[model samples]
Target: LAKTTQPISMDSYEGQEVNITCSHNNIATNDYITWYQQFPSQGPRFIIQGYKTKVTNEVASLFIPADRKSSTLSLPRVSLSDTAVYYCLVGDGTPSSNTGKLIFGQGTTLQVKP
Candidate 1:
């Protein structure tokens, strides 16, 4: 497993775009990168996942460079409701793997103000 590093916290106003980056210097070839957002007392919600290149969904966009050492999660026009802790996870999430276990680090706390 590769360890990840992220900023302690970030602040943004409503309707502004926010990008949170995570670094995984020792990522393995078979590992997949995933991002999750968690609110107070709530379970982590899956935001996005990618192995290489860029992946986007209705909520966020994930940018992974060619080196695969880091990734960025882009949230467009964030609002106060988006304030939460964002986590970057790295592992083989394939069903065949059958691990069903996930490890998370102290995530980046995103504070969205009005």
Candidate 2:
């Protein structure tokens, strides 16, 4: 239960302000880095999480930099219905012990061009 590398596509316009970056780098030690938001048929939710520094809510901001591999998901001032698809999960611990979870490892298509 350790795999994460976000961003598959990104293009902003509506209000401009979107950042999505992730790289787990074999991150372990009860891994904890979660960020999800998929709005195309609805599913992903949880927006922020970290085990280092910086972690905002209200729907964005999470910068974990302390050798925690890598993580950054900040989407402020974005529009066009926030064009969806952004997932990065590196084991957020306890899903009844992994629980066959990979939290999806093929998504990040956010094209809000207008």
Candidate 3:
């Protein structure tokens, strides 16, 4: 399985832009970079996904460089409610990739203050 390395924790304030970077040097060509956000007691919610270049949505944007070895999740104008555990997952997102499953790496705890 591919692995990602990210900061253990980060601090931000309201109305700030927070960028979280994840490193996956062993990423495969078929693998995709995905970002998920998990609240204290709930399951992780999909934030964004990208195979290459940049992908953006209402909530976040995912940036993947040309080499695909690392990615950055950009959260614009983050608020206190945005505080959560952010995870960077690298996989093919297909049944064949992991024999019918996707493996997630440990997450980065982000603290949003007022």
* Number of backbone clashes in candidate 1: 0
Clashes (backbone N, CA, C under 3 Å), per candidate, total 0, 0, 0
Residue 89, candidate 2: how far off, in angstroms?
2.9
Error of 3 at 86 (Å): 0.3
Whole-model lDDT values for every prediction = 0.94, 0.81, 0.90
TM-score of 2: 0.33
Give the candidate number with the greatest lDDT: 1
Question: Which digits, one per residue and each the tens of the lDDT, describe model 3 over residues 14-112?
Answer: 999999999999987788888999998899999999999999999998899999999999999999999999999988755455663467778899999
lDDT of 1: 0.94
How do the predictions measure up, each by TM-score? 0.93, 0.33, 0.93
* Tens-digit lDDT string for candidate 1 (6-102): 9999999999999999999998787899999999999999999999999999999999999999999999999999999999999885566777456
Q: Candidate 2, 105: how far from true, in Å?
A: 0.5
Candidates arranged by lDDT, highest first: 1, 3, 2
